[model samples]
Target: MANALRTFDADVGSAPMDMLSALFEARGWQCDVHSTEEISGKVKGSWATYQLRCIWRREDNVLQLLCLPDIRVSPEKRAPATDLLALVNEQMWLGHFELWSDGGMLLFRHAAMLGDEGLLSLTQAQALVETAIEECDRFYPAFQFVLWSDKSPKDALTSAMVDAAGEA
Candidate 1:
C-alpha cells in the first residue's frame, strides 16, 4: 500500500461515533452526520433516515463514510431519526457486517433485526459489531465505515483500486 493509505491505530472507546469522528478530524479530515430525510429528495422516495458521514481528501480524490442507523433498512413508512432508536429495542437480533473495497476502505453496518417481542442481549449485539469491525480492519488497512445513502460519494473504491494497482 502507498503512504497515502497509511493505517491509523484507532483507540478503542465506548462511543464509536465520537471516537471515529475525533480520530479523522485529528488527521485533518472532516466528518458530517446527515439524515436520510435531509437527502431524501435527492434519492427518490420520502423515506426518513439518518447517517454519519466522514470526508477526507487524498490529493484529488475524496474519501467518505456514511453511517446509517439500522431502521433505515426497515420497510416502514417514513419516520424521523428518532424512529431509528427503536431499532435498538431489546427484542431485536443484532448483527454486524462490513463491506470493503479492494482498494483499502470499508463500509460497516450493524443491525438489530427486530423480532416479534424483545431485543438481543447487549453482549450478543456487540459481538456482532466487533466481528464486523475486526474483519474490515483485517481486509482494508484504510477502512471507513459509512451508511448507504444517495448523498454519499461513490468514487473512493475505484480510485483506491487504481492507486493500489499503480503501486504494484
Candidate 2:
C-alpha cells in the first residue's frame, strides 16, 4: 500500500525544557539530548528544512524539543536574543503541558484496546499525530504556540523547530 500523507507545524520557546524534564522524569520517560546543525532534510526541490530535535519518550508517548534559529538573525548577531527566548519559553511551557495532558488521556483510553502490536500499527500512529494536533490547537490561542499538524513525520520535526526557536 502507498504511504499516507502527513502534515503538522508548531513553534515554541525554551523555558519548558526543565519542566518537561521534570514531568517526564516523574513519569519514567527516557530523555535524550543531542546537538546538531539540522534535524530535517528536504526533497530535491523542497523549501522546508528540518529543525534540531530533543526527544523524550516512555513506553507510550513521545515528547519532542525542537530548536530553530531565526533565519532572519545572522551569525553576525552573536548575542542571544532575549525577546525570542522569552516567547519560546512561554509557548513551550503551554504547548508541552497541553500535549502531556492529551497524550495521557489518549493513552488511558486506548491502552488496553490498543495492546502492544496494535499500538505499533499505522492506525495508532495516525491517532497519535491527530491527538498532538488537536491538543496543540486547543491550547495554541491561549499561549501563542504556532504550529501546523499535517500528520506527517515532518510535522513532528516542525514541532522541534518551535521548541528550538525559543532558545535561539
Candidate 3:
C-alpha cells in the first residue's frame, strides 16, 4: 500500500502561524502572536471563558492547540478528574482532554501533522478553534459536577450529556 501525495509550496511553510493570528483577531478574541511559532488568546464560551494557545513547530511540521476552560480541579479532586477525562477522551474524535500534572488544570489538546510541506489552511485553523471550544462547553458541566458536587464520573457524564430541548 502507498500513501497519497500531498502538494505543497515553499510559501506554505510561512503562512500558517500568521493565518492563525489573523483568524483569531477576526473573531474578536484576544490574540497574541508570541514569536513566529506561537500564539495565545482568550475566548468567551457559554459555560466558561477559555484560554487558547497554538504552537507551530516548523521543524516537525506540526501545529499544536490547547484550550483550557476556566474551571480548575483541585489536587484532591484530581483522581475523579482523571476518571472523567478518561471517559470524556474515549468519546472524542479530534481532540482529547487532559489534566495537567503541574496544577491539575484541565485542557483540551489536539495536534495536526501538516505534512512535510507544513501547509495549513485558514479553514483548518478555524475548525480547530471551534471544535475545542465546543467540546469544552459540552463537557464543562461534567467537570463541575465531579469536582464541586461530588458526583461520580458516570453520573456526571450522564448529567452533562443531557440536551435541554428549549429555554424555560
Candidate 4:
C-alpha cells in the first residue's frame, strides 16, 4: 500500500510555525510569522477580539499559543477575576485562562510538543487555535462582568451562559 511505504522527511522541513502561519493566514487572520522564533496575529470572534501569538521554544521543541483579551483586570477586580478564572480553567480541556499579575492581562495559553511527537499537523495546529479562541470567546463575558460590574464570580459565570434551546 502507498501509505505503508510513505516516509516523513522531518529533517527537510522548517519549524511548526511555518505551517501554522499559513493556516492562520488562510483563515483570514493577517499573521506575522517571518521571524524564526515567534508569530503574532489578530482574531475576531463573535463575542470578543483576541491578540494571537505562537512561539517556538527551542529547548523544549514546543509551540505555544497565547490568546489575550483586550480587557485588563483592574486591581479592584483581581479577586473576582481569580475566582472566575479558576472555575473556567477547570472547565477547559487544553489551555487555561490566566490573569497576569503586573498588568492583569487576561490570556488564554496552550502548548504543543513538536519534535519528539513529530511535526504538528495543520489540523492539529488549527485545533489548538480553535480551542484557545473558543475558550476565550466562551468565557469572555464572564471576565467582562467581573471587571465592570458588581457580580460575584459564580454569578458572572452564570450570566455568560445564555440560554438558546433550539437555536444554534
Compared with the true structure, what per-residue lDDT tens digits does model 4 show for residues 1-168?
122112323244445777667667667787887587789999998676788998888788888899997878788788888999998888788888898888988899998887774466755776888888888878888787778887898988878766212227
What TM-score, computed on C-alpha atoms, does each candidate reach?
A: 0.24, 0.25, 0.88, 0.85
TM-score of 2: 0.25
lDDT of each: 0.30, 0.30, 0.82, 0.77
Higher-TM-score candidate among 2 and 4? 4
Candidate 3: list runs displaced more than 4 Å: 1-14, 164-168
Each model's backbone clash number: 9, 26, 0, 0
lDDT of 3 by residue, 15-105 (tens): 5677777677667789889888999999999798899999988999999999999677898898898999999998899999998888778
Error of 1 at 63 (Å): 26
lDDT of 2 by residue, 54-138 (tens): 3434343344433222123233221222232333345442233312222221110111133332222333333433343343333
- For candidate 2, the per-residue lDDT at 34 reads 38
Candidate 3 clashing pairs? none
Instruction: Give a tens-digit lDDT track for model 1, residues 1-168.
Output: 223223323222222333343333443334453431111101111122223343323332222333432222222222211132232222124333232323222234443332332223333323543444343333231112112332112233334335445653
Against the true structure, whose lDDT is highest? 3
lDDT of 2: 0.30
Rank ordering of all candidates by TM-score, starting from the highest: 3, 4, 2, 1
Best TM-score goes to which candidate? Answer: 3
RMSD of 1: 17.2
Worst 10 residues of 2 by lDDT: 103-112
Model 2, position 105, has a per-residue lDDT of 17
Give, for candidate 1, the lowest lDDT window spanning 10 residues.
36-45
